[model samples]
Target: MVEITNMCRTTGCAIGDIKLYCAGFTSANLINPLIFRHLPTPNHDYCIVNNGNPLSAGAVLSFHYDNTFMYRDFSVSTVTCIS
Candidate 1:
């Protein structure tokens, strides 16, 4: 699940050009494939990914966005492990 917040108070940004990528433990060293493309947004969108496989330990997930004009890129990562 991804929640994007537009910090721009006066102007809304476009998130439709973003890309999501994922790679499991076995492929950690290699670049992962594009899991999702062109996320839908309605200004401050909360997106849930349902098509990809469940994430396991040592899995890495990332997103890429193109910053053009007045847009800035933001990246965040969170990890949780259960024993």
Candidate 2:
């Protein structure tokens, strides 16, 4: 089991307009049906998920927005998983 908390900020656009991407893995094993919870942030209405479907290990997640000129930064505040 693993828990990850992602935090992000957007520039040149509203948070609601920003999109995020992600990838997950466990050592050499890929995590299918990658499960996670979205935490709330102040003034941010953005939510990130595994494409509304399960995520596989080593899978590349991508995000986009209407404005391609916007810049967004993402960070994993907390990551908890068995090694």
Candidate 3:
């Protein structure tokens, strides 16, 4: 399992580029294999992850989601953990 500190070490990636990333926890073994794509929008506010591929752990995982437009700092609207 890659550490959270290791996953996405860089900052500010464009919406639709091939990003080299790493993930935290063994679960990433299951979620990091597939390619991720962010949809185009008027404001690069959020991205939709395609989930034709299914992901699961023995236990259900819940992600805390949030959105921000007030700050100019980088943010990702949504992310799909996949493998």
The root-mean-square deviation over C-alpha atoms between each candidate and the true structure, in angstroms, is 14.6, 15.2, 15.2
Clashes (backbone N, CA, C under 3 Å), per candidate, total: 0, 1, 3
Poorest lDDT segment (10 consecutive residues) of candidate 2: 10-19
Q: Write the per-residue lDDT of candidate 3 for residues 1-83, one digit (tens) a residue.
A: 11111143234321222232212112222342333323344543443332223323232222322234222332433334443
Q: Say which prediction, candidate 2 or candidate 3, comes out ahead on TM-score.
A: 2
lDDT of 1 at 40: 46
- After TM-score superposition, the amount by which residue 4's alpha carbon in candidate 1 deviates from its true location, in angstroms, is 13
How much is 59 displaced in model 1, in angstroms? 0.5
lDDT of each: 0.32, 0.32, 0.29
Candidate 1 per-residue C-alpha lDDT over 24-72 given as tens digits, one digit per residue, 9 for 90 to 100:
1122133224443323454322222322333433334454433233222
lDDT of 1 at 47: 25
User: For residues 26-79, could you state the per-residue lDDT of candidate 2 as single tens digits?
Assistant: 123333432322324553433345424433333444433233233344444333
